[model samples]
Target: MTGQEENGATRKGPTRALVLHPDLKSERRRRAPELALAEAVSLAAALADLAVTGAEVVRLARPQPGMLFGAGKIEELKARIEADEVELVLIDGPVTPVQQRNLEREWKVKLLDRTGLILEIFADRAHTREGVLQVELAALSYQRTRLVRAWTHLERQRGGLGFVGGPGETQIEADRRAIDEEVVKIRRQLAKVVRTRELHRAARRKVPFPIVALVGYTNAGKSTLFNRMTGAEVLAKDMLFATLDPTMRGVLLPSGKKVILSDTVGFISDLPTQLVAAFRATLEEVLEADLILHVRDIAHPETEEQAADVREILESLGVEEEVPVFEVWNKIDLLTLEQRAALLVQDARTPGIHTVSALSGEGLEALLDAISTALDDRRTIETLTLGFEEGRARAWLHEQGVVKAERDGDEGHEMTVALTERQRAQLERLRQG
Candidate 1:
């Protein structure tokens, strides 16, 4: 094992990993098998310090129930793993518990399916308390059914099973019950966290800034675009799931209006149901956003499929049908001159499409102008008389830089200020209070 220092102590390097994607030629696929295999390799590499030794797409007419792959195919992969000295096999699809156990016993190697690997990545990368709790909850939900993994202490029996049993409580049953209890505790704690988060959002509502949310498929350059727009040093990497927790920063639009830009966890095709449910509270930023920026990795070969997946997840989360969303075609710098021109033409024909390279800063001015226009459309200049007794409200308007002009009136101060519908509603709420 290779030793490296992290945080203060030495840590062992990750296990050597082999990745495989099952390519069923008889079945239809939205994305090419080669691209899917490459993505699988990337996902394997993304897991903390993992070294991907080899990766390939295995052609299959159909999967075997006993072992995902046939005996001949298993021997072929076993030979490859031995040749490469691979300790871990990461399958880019679901594996039933029996199939997983059989494969592990046959190859004498650890196996992880897509969902299990994702949970591992999330557990390693989560930073915030809520993020940590959510990942744990999702992981427990996943493990409740798969307690037969050899590493689990299933051989250790519990005391006394009143029901018909050869021995006492089996390890699997005990583990399942323990996981269920832990899930209940986590849900209770998470509910309290959610309530506190709602309180924070309610407090932010009084500040009168429109929330603009950034969302996209994994590694589509959303965080890079967020850094460019907000001038904040958010983690921006080519790796998938690099940004796990949500990040928000205030930015000034071209029209001199300040707005909050929120960067959220990237979406992936076939995202685990448990993760989607657990991260729903984190994704509420999208549901509550005044505008959503649907960033796209335009240069990717599977860009259309990825975009479809992103839209599917958004709809699954019950994003409002009427919420405004803008398509941001990113990574224009990776395209050839001819491809760039073709994209520009297509973007021109599209109603809400904006083409840009977040790295090179191309077409950002027009994008910023579009954002300004979208937000400005909601703002209105209105004349209002704030009584001297309402000095606090007058001060708030001034602090928000919404007061364009003001004058002393007979009873109070008369002012004309630009305000959004949300801002006006907040003002009314403040007065009512």
Candidate 2:
């Protein structure tokens, strides 16, 4: 029987879900409970076949060990769940295995914590082989810690990693050894994917175009901006994690200079550590970026906090300090006229900030001009004299199209080339060898 079937009755339509955000007073760096709950509802909406019935913030002085909520509170939630016929409860916080088990028994419904929900979204959205493997690896790592005996029947009924619910056959409980073996297999598959990606990167490096990567909080308009700039139909939506895998497209700037633009997965506050580690390889585009555009949803209530989260993740990824970063304040179309005017004034005063509404194309001309100018600043024209023996270096300079002028010389040739810092370094290495 499918997971939707209960007591011989096949459930119809989307699974009714209730989202709860546990507001712990003792926790540091706490977000507004209402906002957290709202985000959770949005997250629930991101998953297909999950209709959120109700959502609220549950205040707690402290958490109960066995059941995240106190006995009385648990009973209260159970009554509400029964009344609403909620088949699934999504907790916007971590829940231990014991706590999850107890809550499932008490509430008589499937429960997923924030991490599980995020994994489900990723699994559902991940279209690439690398992305799928990474999600599976992260899910396996998470499941290894919370595996329950005789829960294989539950595993078969979910669309993604079997966390929520789908259709499949009943299976045996997954032992730790079995989980470990699966992990190994996924890692092997992922290594192959990474190698292929590395080859692609190497090919891009040969093209000599600067890589500009867009990164920001989820639903912060990175993909929208990318589509507006590159004219590519990448999925740009209001949902969280609309674009999971990294996408790259070549764009010709108004200055007639070409560049590769990369749109990456958006960052969120308190992202699961397992995913952070697992998706590191996926974010290598940012590492190789010549410039990073930190897109911000200026209209979001927690815009500053969201920007902070993106910076934190970028730092963790060890992006080079030398790579130039420009802040793109997006979504001005959602702001009031007065607010938008004020933002534009502030943006003018900021050295590395640009304001735009990717949806409405407001201020995009200026943003694109700024991008072209920023890329130009990375390059410098230098006159160099190469010996006859350095034929390879001369060929490379011509191939890069950095050679602005060249003249025959007594030894070999003298050339004037406009080269970016990376190109200059490569030229020097060639000369040294």
Candidate 3:
């Protein structure tokens, strides 16, 4: 059988899937197993063609090396799967290649671990060229690791390292070599796309508009808020990984200051390592942001945990410490009146936090006012000394319309300029360069 056939019997309609979250006793748990299972179900729902037939948290004292579950549990699950006619089993945790192969053979169903499931979702949601390439690259990297003897499709094609290929090459080795070659090819394509993105970013920088990035956990109403703030019709569905690619729109703030608003892919707990590396470029917008709005789904039960995960991802992405961040407590409409009132009271007291319901437009005015105030360009007049050789810095200051007066001196030029903090930083960079 081909790899796809071995994965699952060919079906004409939606694939019936069973979601399982392993509640291992020995593992240090970060999230409740029930909640994790619910999330897994939601993730399965994100795929249009997947029909989740059932979901549950399966408890385990320990994992079997080859099967990942004991004989009794395996047989029980197999019976249940057969009874339910489930074609796919989605495990909400890591599963090794050997265990996956064994489980598929024992259960007579295709198996997808957490990473594989996520890759499938990404593959389905990716739209842009770069997004598609990144997902393909991540999938290839993931597939290379799971190239067992059962994946017969890999043996049909062979083109890499012509001299090394002969009767001596094993199927698994050929498959891995092909995947590696594809990875290299995709990297080259990604580099070109990244260069184009950089050029666009450079052009945006010249526009003098600060970039305000909306970042949060998946399904946290970031896209809804982006649409609300910019009046742009971006996909704002309440789905995990709904917005896979970065989108930017120009918005005139309430204070008449124009800023570029960016909506980026949402973060998730325990994001696959392959995706984290592959989608790094997609999240680079967060790094260049002059201000970040950390939108939160306040209605979610695991709101605090989700916030921590977002912060962890942000820190890992190397977001600068100096960039200002505003915590946006979104989805207030989902809260009860008493809860909303109490949240508003707390939001009023907090300096950097705002509560709003992006869907209903409640508290959006105040949020906008706060965003305007935060991005206000309060200027300061200062005397700057630039050497004659530092013409680029002087030109930049003049180009920014910050230079008020200038005079030539023996060692350099003395200039009086009104500068915002951003301009000062830009000038400093120009000098350093």
List ranges where model 1 is wrong by over 4 Å.
1-12, 150-170, 379-433
Regions of candidate 3 where Cα sits further than 4 Å from its true position:
1-11, 149-170, 377-381, 391-409, 413-433
Model 1 poorest 10 in a row by lDDT: 156-165
At residue 140, what lDDT does model 1 achieve?
75
Which candidate do you rate higher for TM-score, 1 or 2? 2
Model 2 TM-score, 2 decimals? 0.89
TM per model? 0.82, 0.89, 0.89
- Measured with C-alpha atoms, the lDDT of residue 48 in candidate 1 is 65
Give the Cα RMSD of candidate 3.
5.1
Alpha carbon lDDT at 22, candidate 1? 89
Per-residue accuracy of model 1 over 258-352 as CA lDDT, tens digit each: 88999999999889999999999889999878789999999999999999999999999988765678999999999999999999999889978
For candidate 3, give the lDDT. Answer: 0.83
The number of clashing residue pairs in each candidate reads 0, 4, 0
RMSD of 2: 3.7
